[model samples]
Target: MEEIALHILDLVQNCVEAGASEVSIAITECRRDNLLTVKISDNGRGMDQATLAAVTDPFFTTRSTRKVGLGIPLLKAAAEQCNGSFTIESSEGKGTQVVASFALDHIDRAPLGSMADTLAAVFAVHHVDVHYRHEVDGKVFMLDSKEIRQLCGDELMHPRVIVWLRAYIEEHEKQVGGEQ
Candidate 1:
């Protein structure tokens, strides 16, 4: 993934495909510590220990439609190369959690990317509930699909809703990310 947001999207997609009904994504940037952390958790049919052990292998995939799973491997490599760490924990019939940390200001670290767009894209398609939290320095921004659903009903996939969502998220991204 070119951007960290894309990685988040890919991981969220994986969660959806794994029968997840709920997903959580958290991005924290600690400039003082020079650390950027991304944690994604999903309530889905998780992998067994054996599958989890092999997930880091790019060529080892459970999907029959594809021969390789590059998302996890690529993300792992991206973090490791940036003097960071990556870990994934899963339990069969439970859920999965992936955490990756990177050197925040590392020259090789990819940009965080357009989170608003990425999230809007997800909302425009999948109906899975998502809780997204992003923090930069000490500022924070949060979005909960369940809350939005309660207000807008289940028709959140509509174009207008998605447009509004994108703008809303974008504005918050700017504010919380300190772009303003």
Candidate 2:
């Protein structure tokens, strides 16, 4: 993918397909170390060893909706191109965790595109709880829908909150990203 956010979207979609009710996404950008890492964990029906091993294969997919699987394979290629790595671990009854890391300064490293927009898109539509934490250098930005629900009460789904989140994400994208 051209942008890391698109990769994130595809990975999270896998979580949803696995019957996840809770997903956690963490992005840590260490500019000084020239590293960018993304970790996505989900409390969903996980995979067997065989399935996990084949997850990176373009020809292997558990879904009947499509004949090919390019998400994980494409992501793997992207990371490797940047002198990075991709790893996935899971337990059948427990959950799954996917980690992808890239060399920040590598010429082939893909852009970590509007990440805030990616988070907002995942949160607004899923209805399920997601814990999102972004760390740029040492600074952190956190969004917990459960917390929002607690504060907003029955109005948790209010259109205003969604709009506010979208605006907040867009406005402070650079700040949250440590670009400024």
Candidate 3:
């Protein structure tokens, strides 16, 4: 993926497929620390120890469709290439968490990309509850799909509403992250 947000979308989609009802995503950009971290946690049917161990292998996947699963491996490579780290943990009956960090100013670190579009795409399809938080330095912007469902009566799939949500998220992202 050319963008971190796309990677995020792929990871979260996997969680959704795994029967997640709630997902939490956090992005922390700390320029002072020269780090960019992305964490995603989902309340879903997590992997067994055996599966977890093989998760980073491109040849292993829970899906029956294709032979390869590249999301996790790609993210791992992306992080390591940027002089950072990647970690994933899961419990069979509990959930899963994946965290990838990148050197904030690394020459090869991918752009964060349009979180607005990424999130809007999620809401457009799945009804999963999503809590997303983005922080740059000390500034923060958050979006809760459940809260929006409550306030807007679950019209997030509406075309007009999706447009509004994307624009809203983009504006907040620019404000909190200081112009992308």
Per-candidate Cα lDDT values, in order, are 0.92, 0.84, 0.92
Q: What are the models' TM-scores?
A: 0.97, 0.91, 0.97
TM for candidate 1 is: 0.97
Per-residue lDDT over 5-105 for candidate 3, one digit per residue giving the tens place of the 0 to 100 score: 99999998999988999999999999889999999999999998899999999998878899999989999999999999999999987899999999988
Q: Give the clashing pairs for model 1.
A: none
Output the lDDT of residue 162, model 2. Answer: 71
Native RMSD of candidate 3 (Å): 1.0
Order the candidates by TM-score, highest first — what do you get?
3, 1, 2
Model 1 over residues 1-180: C-alpha lDDT tens digits? 779888989999999999999999999999899999999999999998899999999999878988998989999999999999999999888899999999987889999999998999999999799999999999999999999999999778999999999999999999987322
Backbone-clash count (model 2): 0
**Candidate 1 whole-model C-alpha lDDT, 0 to 1:** 0.92
Using lDDT as the measure, name the better of candidate 1 and candidate 2: 1
**Model 1: which ten-residue window has the lowest total lDDT?**
171-180
| lDDT tens readout by residue for model 2, 127-147 | 667888888989888878788
